[model samples]
Target chain A: MASKPECACGDTSAVAGGKKRIIFPCAGTANVGLISNAAAFQLADEGYGVATCIALLGSADTGLRRRIAEADEVVIIDGCPATCGAKIADLQGIAIDQHIVITALGIDKVYERNYTEEEVERVVSAAWEGKGRT
Target chain B: MKIEVLGTGCMKCKRLLKNVEVAVQELGIAAEIKKVDDITEIINRGVMLTPALAVDGEMKVSGRVADVKELKEILKG
Candidate 1:
């Protein structure tokens, strides 16, 4: 396999009032998982910070780990209660600033890959509202 | 040169270690390869994914297996 080029040079400067945030979406194949992915995109598009790859973080990719470490806030958009993203982050000693479990937000986890934009918006709005904040 | 296979003793991790050994032998390079199954050590190495390859402390790959050819290229470098 070809070695992947490392994009370790990410903008570490604060985006949201001196807060540099990174979002980790579970991005599972299931519906809730898809929602999490969509929400991440929306969040990034809304200038909430960049949406990052969970696999790279799980692999402890050097550049990505550095980015996570530098970020003021680390958000995990887990698809379900299993919280795979959070679990992965924990293993890497990543201190999560905000945790959002889609199922916990009163959204049903349908096996089918069907989710409306509103559902994605709900997660995005929840993120802005700090609903998942401790 | 020093090479390390990072994993938690999973089947795939062992397989990667074995593959690396074969690659070194086939290439006729005198390289020392070690299996890092210790969790703390692996974490300190900055790896959360198993079956990872590190050449001289630089991570080559992780979260997936690389074939003999790929290992050979990494070793050659």
Candidate 2:
């Protein structure tokens, strides 16, 4: 037996339109960076949020500020443990609903041809699962 | 080809720009490298990743800079 009621925040929101979901990717120069981008892309494709680069967020002329202010949910994907994406969001004072670190899961840091899309997808799913908890 | 490494001038972006230049020189290709710090233009490129490398008008790579050898291959292509 399962309940059929729908929730927007997966909690208690009824109307689900323009929730303004946004994802920030660290996009560093390592395996974790690629994973972060992959995860962000998947999240955006899944309609969880708009996938905007953290760098863009840091430099945009108040556009990033606007996105942060209007975003109902903000997700950050940082490669490795540096957490640059998270740091950027923190500096912007934007509360992140989901923060994902690929290397934190025991995956060795790498770049170039050593990384696989499957691993990135796994991390993205994990981030998605952790959503709305922030 | 004009290549631009887009980032907030982070170490990674700088490093990638260096690699791109090295590759271009090694391959004896004629290109100029530019660093873009404008967030609006970066976002306009629809790149959701930093340390992005653009070849000419196309985004050749993003998130990480490829190795010198790999960069050479990409540039040669």
Candidate 3:
């Protein structure tokens, strides 16, 4: 029996050559917020990027901020127009290479507790594709 | 009493700082208030949100700006 090949999509080191791409998700209390979080986690798990804490960024942690400032790229995911995650990065003068808004993807912003796997997959694909970049 | 406010000097962070000052004054407490504006230092302290309050190195409030009333409760504790 032949062994299955390892997925290169999950090899972050190989993709970035040791550089890190950070992702920040709003993770708000809304459905879209949760979807953003799910997408971010999926991207991290797939080695597309490292999912860092948005709260830590908001707190203005010098180390984390420095890491962001020096990162090769930064991705921000917002559940709604509030753009909490992106705003935090902006406050610290960190530039966002890509910004994804779940609501802008045609997902309604509601208080649902659960989201479909398809929705999560859509977000993951968008992030991986670096959508919302000019 | 030692109180530390963690933030990067944003509007909300400044509001939190003001609230803390007002709280301390109203309570007539002798406290050492410090503003942690350095991002590296803020991260080392394990704060995940801005405008956070730490009492004697212990984190208490985070993420949101506490009103004067809320600050009073936090300082009192």
- Computed on alpha carbons, the lDDT of every model, listed in order, comes to 0.77, 0.68, 0.75
What lDDT tens digits, residue by residue, belong to model 2 across residues B1-77?
88888876654466567677767888998888899867777777776666677888788876654446667877887
Please report, as a residue range, the 10-residue window in candidate 3 chain B with the lowest summed lDDT: B62-71
Cα lDDT for residue B45, candidate 3: 73
Write candidate 1's Cα lDDT for B1-77 as tens digits: 99998887654465567678868988999888988877777767666455688998899977544546668888888
> Which stretches in model 1 have alpha-carbon errors above 4 Å?
A1-16, B1-77
Instruction: Kindly report which residue stretches of model 3 are placed more than 4 angstroms away from their true locations once superposed.
Output: A1-7, A14-19, B1-77
Give the Å shift of residue A107 in candidate 1: 0.7
- Model 2 CA lDDT for position B59: 83
Q: How well does candidate 1 match the true structure in TM-score terms? A: 0.56
DockQ value of candidate 1: 0.01
Q: First chain TM-score in every candidate?
A: 0.87, 0.78, 0.86
TM-score of each: 0.56, 0.52, 0.57
